[model samples]
Target: MYTNSVLQTDYPWTKTPLVASAPMLNIAMAPLAVSVSAAGGLGFLAGGFDVSALESNLEEAVHLIKQSSAPIQETYASTAVLPIGVGFLNWGADLPKSIAAIEKYRPCAAWLFGPRSIPDDLRPWVEQVRAVTEGKTKIWVQVGTVAEAVAVAEALNPDVLVVQGADAGGHGLAQSASVITLVPEVKDVLTTRQVKNDIPLLAAGGIVDGRGMAASLALGASGVAMGTRFLASSEAKIARGYQDEVLRVSDGGSNTSRSKVYDRARGILSWPVQYDGRGVINKSYIDSAEGGMSDEENRALYKEELKKGDLGWGPNGRLTTYAGTGVGLVKTKLPAGEIITNMIQEAKAILQQLKA
Candidate 1:
């Protein structure tokens, strides 16, 4: 039986980061999130866009969960069911609409990101969701530094603290602490601050597999949060070319830098200055960074990249290849359910051997 307490919740425990993936967007692959939950990991629906999409995904997830339960029942023999959660990029998505959707669907939790203060301007919104959820909904805030983690933990006491490293793909703090160094430090702080032990600690950024999961547990994290790995999975929404790039690119291939070039082009204006995005280095990106190109030229370049394919879709260099350092470990995209099962099995294998 899965011992993860969050699994006991009626809601989903989001198996992977729910954004920018190819398979996840597939309605057929939607069962993957529920599969992760059945395996004792939470699966999150990516709700970074708007209310309608959020509602659609939530409804779809619920449908999939119901749809997948027969197989789970056969396998678990009356065990508690797995939970499914939803993710919203606080920096880009609309909070109210997302919150409303959560209130209506009532997911297991809400994962929020963007470099800003924890217990941020969204506290009331979070509280409102909690009220609607009757305390069923949790808040998993992603942070890059011990200070930020500590701050957020102290203020909101979110259900989970996702400690993201600088190596994490997507948007993250411009210069932040590495996950290896920060997890233990945050664990100590949680102790000194007298936070509840059951409050889970999740380590993100560059985590790829069972080895990474083992490492996170050793570092005092209850579990690991993976984005890049899922992005490469068959259920994600990325282009085939993009998935190939993630696999072919070495772990060091994530040397991709962070910047707001894409944010500007995408028209998401409210992101804080402390953070930037990581993406593949490309010509449009290079041209955007140079400042030599006129606005017309830059826009044209951005459009050109988009036309080239999904690889160049975000902004100039800002195309949405949000992968972490773990991309190197990824050899191919698999079903999200298979990925979770394999990760746990491999970690358990290694951990059992270590006890010997």
Candidate 2:
């Protein structure tokens, strides 16, 4: 029975800093959620890619939050935080099951991605989420375009709008602007419409450090939604091989690129053509690109890679490693709480220096 969280609304994050960990399928799990919450940030459970484990994950998130540090413990007594949240992909997949499961958890907010158009295309899902949350839980919508963000911000009672840039990991709009170029445009539109107080803008993509967070704020984003950074968190439920790949490619993050390589390998060709994602440019992707291997061969390679367990990643590894261009900032595999706290501290220092 937690009260309202300081972060659950459009309040000034001047002292508390609003940082959120983006939900990554097969990666963001209970420990990750708890750690983020304990750090006084947003912890969103990954509710997309399938709903089979939704209930268990949400339950585990609660369990971990309860067992976490004092900030989260106080959330249960006061209204400073709701402990955890959940996110879902609404573009190519069905959302009913995911929605149903998360509705019971009563998360602080529900994040929805792939809103082709807002209020109109997203209303039904929003309505369902409202009904389940009794309109108490806030709505956080993610969009890749300024047009989509403006429309959604204008028509809905959304609490937050996540502007995902083309540099993001996982599935993202194939044709989208870079974070630096796109965030300000979205901010201008929202400010012009006078919706800044109602809908806070969060910049997502290639950002994994305090410098990026500070830069986003300077560009008009209220916070940063980081996915790749959390993928390196010690609590992330990713394989060791996956985590290593994330760290290995950290040389200014030039080792990754946007492509549909994983979707093709996994037979997930249903995503709209406009949506593609960034993945680590591994040996398999290079080989498959030159028609040197068949789909069957690629699938076989993926299977073998999975069989090698957590330590099995290299040139021959067939795992789908999604990462951002800013992977270079991810220098270590630290705890999620440590990452959030350090990022906030670093941002504060940078902002202070600029003020000086």
Candidate 3:
């Protein structure tokens, strides 16, 4: 009967790591999930955006889990118990398609992000997953603001609520509060409302190292979710040049901005209106307006940039590099497990120093 910092005495996540990899749109695939889970933290295979081959990805998640070097391989069988987590975008996910895949595989958790509807679609989706999962799957939602958190909490009980700040890489809330401000604000709202249970809060954005994780814990979060940090991981499916840029721009987080310049350049016309994409600025950024470049301009830029293929870095890099303010901390492309393990060790060291 020893008290372990990583073990939860609450309703969800009995035992977990201090860090979980944030689910990126097309990048949070099977390999990354299995690797992070095997390393003792939670990881989710992205359930939306490029999900036409979801079944194959789910199958691969199982295969990787079974093949993992960790002893968790035995605990997580090749059954429908869902050894790994899968996430779907609330704004644009094909619910029935996502549900069908989840029903077939039955991951341990389902993450819903980039909200478009709640109380109606969210409630039904949660109920359906519960009915099929026998209430075994944990429901996790990512909200950009305190209001969103309170609204979701009132609608249906969730296992985890992610408070993502504005400094985060990739698409997030239009005008978001920082993690320091947002997580506490959301927690206080939930507490004051006197919800049935004190939902767990996981802080995200600009959390690149153990110091960030430790700080989040001190600020009253159950854990921290890292997106930009993991983008540099060997398992993450991103262009090598993008990873290089992540390391190159460590101290200059201000260089990263929120804009649809890259999205338009790539011909992505319809991202959710309430959200915006964040990443390192490229050629498209300078000439682009606040609303983004015109289709004709972006098309011309895309055609020119596409010719570079893999060498998409430096001053003129035009590819969509979804990242956060912590882009500079990403130094190397290590394996997913190594990243988690090192982060845990670093957290322990930082916490010990604070205690002393």
Candidate 4:
């Protein structure tokens, strides 16, 4: 078989276009997931926030998937095994709720992000879910670096691996390796370790189109997971204003800063020592404190900004706008399915042209 680069190998995954959207709270992640799956890709409903929201989103996502499948529509039936997944913040919010959710939903896959390694307790959680789902469900863990990925892979024994680069939008590894630089390195590491599980390696952060998809796969990634690009889609749950900001921002996007400002104000208890989130630089959030203000001060400023409706100050503004470096590439909001389909088609074209 011909290969472009990165010593391409046939893995368990069929080398398809895979896009995973960040599960936003209150907003429906299911519709977005279903839309992407309907377009012949995968979708994951985010579930790590308030316990209520998590439960609600899971139930609603299942309901939507079932209802949308009514009448044996060819469209729905055609994509029945679209590889839908669900994700949760590993070190944020209530882990119990997330655990219970996996058992209840039994999604095709479960993704966990944050923390360098999967805690001992999480092993049981993973095992329980795997057992409850009768081993049909796969487990995916997201990490920032090659070392972190290896550590988690060894500890968790997840069915798949997701290496999220620093450019990934939302809360990710602070100041870590870029995805372009890390994918092949991680791939080499996995191969060296004598692990032949054929785990699908997913490249995240700053991937938007066929060019990016081809680049990542060529670099030893089995697939690509995109968040920001999908968030701008019509099926996404974000407000129009939020999506507009995402498109307006540049690729670098004013040096995205990660901090605990928003989580504290929202009263969402995240691990103080473990992780922070990256969001766009909002004027009001910057005004709350001098450059050196304490995290608490920033939280107060976030709260104050929440009170003022003007300046577009709110969660969409004061809170971090989770986006990847590819934000610059996102120009318009299209349906999630169209975006996924186009990227896959474009990638195939690029690869075919390269073969010729």
TM-score of each: 0.83, 0.89, 0.92, 0.84
List, residue by residue over 1-356, the lDDT tens digit for candidate 4. 21312212111122254555555444438788767665656677776645557667666666666665332134234433224577766555465666676667666677776543466435656777677777656777887888877887777777767888877777776657877888888878878895645566788887988898888888877778888788788888876666777777774545455655545555566553556566666643465433555667666666776554444532346655666778778888899878987888899899999989
**How many residue pairs in model 2 have overlapping backbones?**
3
Candidate 4, poorest ten consecutive residues by summed lDDT? 4-13
Could you give candidate 3's per-residue lDDT for residues 1-356 as a string of tens digits?
11234224221232344567888878889888877777777888887754577889999988887788554475555334755678877666777777788788888888888656785457777888888878667788888998989988888788788889998998888788889999888888899998735577888998888888877877778888888988888899877777778777756466788876767777775667778888787777766854455667866876887778767565567776778888877888888888888877787798888789
Best-first order by TM-score: 3, 2, 4, 1
Model 4 misplaced stretches (Cα beyond 4 Å): 1-15, 24-28, 67-83, 93-96, 253-255, 260-269, 272-274, 284-290, 308-317
Q: Any idea what lDDT model 3 has?
A: 0.76
**For all the candidates, what are their Cα RMSDs to the real structure?**
4.5, 3.7, 2.8, 4.4
Task: Pick the winner on lDDT between candidates 1 and 4.
Answer: 4
CA lDDT of each candidate? 0.65, 0.76, 0.76, 0.66
Q: Clashing residue pairs, candidate 3?
A: 82-107, 169-323, 169-324, 250-328
How does residue 302 of candidate 2 score in lDDT? 73
Model 1 lDDT tens row, 1-356: 12455533433333322111211222213455555565556666666544456677666666666656454433223432225667766655676787678777666667777634444545765677688777777778777888877777777778877888877777788888777888888888888888656567788876788888877788878777777788766666567767777777674443465666655555556768887776655554566676555446666666666666755543234345656777778897787767877887888887889889
- Give model 1's clash tally: 27
Model 3 alpha-carbon drift over 4 Å, by segment: 1-17, 78-80, 119-121, 290-293
Instruction: Enumerate clash totals for all models, in the order shown.
Output: 27, 3, 4, 1
Instruction: Quote the lDDT for 240 in model 4.
Output: 60
